[model samples]
Target: AAALISGHEDAYDGFICDEQSVPAAPGEFGVALDASLAVWQQKGYRGIWLKMPAAKAHVIGHAVDRGFEFHHAEKEYVMLTRWLPSSENKLPPNASHQVGMGAFVMNERREVLVVQERSGPLRGQGVWKMPTGLVQQGEDISEAAEREVLEETGIRARFDAVLAMRQAHGFAFGKSDMFFVVALKMEAGPQARELCMQEDELVGVRWMGLEEYLAVPFTAARPLFQKIHAAILAYVNGTY
Candidate 1:
């Protein structure tokens, strides 16, 4: 018989399998996994977390056959989960927060970079807001902010400091959202001032005076927007 998989109990009374200890062969892995599951169940373990590296992917089928479900995956590995008891599985869901950022780029002329989104809630509403987008996996908020500014307006900018943050629930797919308002400095180049708006996602991109932007009907109507813009202005004026 194959040796039982090596692992330790988690704080939540769950067993976390050691990836390095997983059997390389499918047949051996199946036998070892079964033995481990039996032992865990006998010990009244609540859940089992199996981390399988890409090299041991062949054994993933064995874990699945034993009722393990995919929890999440990365480029080099996959995480499988199983609840030992028959009662409802209390295993916590994977990553619950979605991060987003808005780029606040201003020039010496007191003009801020703004974009007219071709789609989204503000589309066709004449709302000119700061360039914003969701942060990609493994990307930092500052990086996302600069990237959004560059992508939407074709104006290169360097990350400064995060001026403010807002959190809200009931976002897309029931995930919580973390919105970061980041200050960015426009880079020195001809492209920095030229307009090359992303046609698919933006209808227009331009530099609007701070007061003009803050006066937009949409911006003027929302207190949050009012405060956020005030904060950005304070940061630029060295008063923040």
Candidate 2:
């Protein structure tokens, strides 16, 4: 028997087949795979997703031969999906799946915190972006956002909410990068006291008015800056 999962907010409604769920029998895999797809289709699900441990290549190969397409992968598993009769069958925007976090912090004066990297491709290019970094292994996304802000700008902040998220393939050295821009409230009192730059890594750290930040000319990050500016506007207008 195959395990069918549904009613989950983050996952698509689908069925999963694997060693644990379906015991390995000589020709049982093919029979189970077809039966699961048939049941899901009969139940009116638009798509079916299959996830298997990377070690189960044979099982995954069978599903792939039956039209399951690659979706994404993780350290221990690979995800594959097949669209049902009424499904659109669109692939995810980025399959490489590198996750990153960014901090959009605003002070009480409505000024946005910005940073300039000391080194890397954009160093000294006059393009200022939010405090951002790739999330470390096993790290919480929210914690990663807060940590990145403190590391680059030396300004501690509290995560307010996730304002926006986007994915781009071949970003930052040709790797797929999924970026999350989170809203952070600058901590008050002693915590918010100074503009300390990570000297070795950042060229500058300062707070600028949202409008001023938006109006500044950007080199390669113009699109991203515009998106962040839009997110700020949305927050102010209570749309986000």
Candidate 3:
């Protein structure tokens, strides 16, 4: 016989299994899970959420055999979800927005940091843009901006403030994107003026005059880019 499984009720009248209460043996886990599902159904639970850590991956097959479907996964754990109700399942989807950060780093000489990507939409186009990258999990926007600037141009900078934000739908994999443009002041040191471009991702990294950056063909073509340029200018001029 398997031990009783315990869980808590969720806001949606669902059940969230206590991962710590999972049985050690796969057979015991299967028996406990089946009993829990039957109890939950009798209690009128509409959905069930179960998180299985990588260490307990062997038990995932048991959950699948009981009707749980993969919802999402991270490095340490995987989330499995199941709709218990016979009616239409109304559980919300996983994360839908990808957050990105752009760094507008400028030095005392008023030259802005820019990079020419070796790959991407601007590859081989001679278009220079601010260093940008996706915000990693558990990273702040400002920290991501600083990290991107450092990784792409080898320039250390301090985050000042967010200059602008842009949102759009129909991005990669049918998900939306939220882009943040942030202002950063270059740190004083020999590395500040040195160029050490990331070879694989960038063909060139250099500092260009702010006016020249704003006049680039790529910048002129996009209204949002022009707006971000204006915001950076305002921030530098202390009028932001």
Taking the tens digit of each residue's C-alpha lDDT, what string does model 2 give over 37-119? Answer: 77777876655556767666667777787888877777887777787775466545434567998788888787888888888
Candidate 2, pairs of clashing residues: none
Give model 3's TM-score versus the native structure.
0.84
Off by over 4 Å in 1: 1-13, 16-36, 43-45, 50-80, 85-92
Give TM per candidate.
0.75, 0.57, 0.84
lDDT of 3 at 97: 91
- Show where candidate 3 strays beyond 4 Å: 1-4, 10-12, 20-30, 55-65, 86-92
Q: lDDT value for candidate 1? A: 0.88
Q: Is candidate 1 or candidate 2 better by TM-score?
A: 1
Candidate 1: residue 148 Cα off by (Å): 1.5
Stretches of candidate 2 off by over 4 Å are: 1-95, 172-174, 219-221
The lDDT ranking, best first, is: 1, 3, 2
| Worst 10-residue lDDT window, candidate 2 | 3-12
Q: After superposition, how far is residue 108 of candidate 2 from its true place, in Å?
A: 0.9
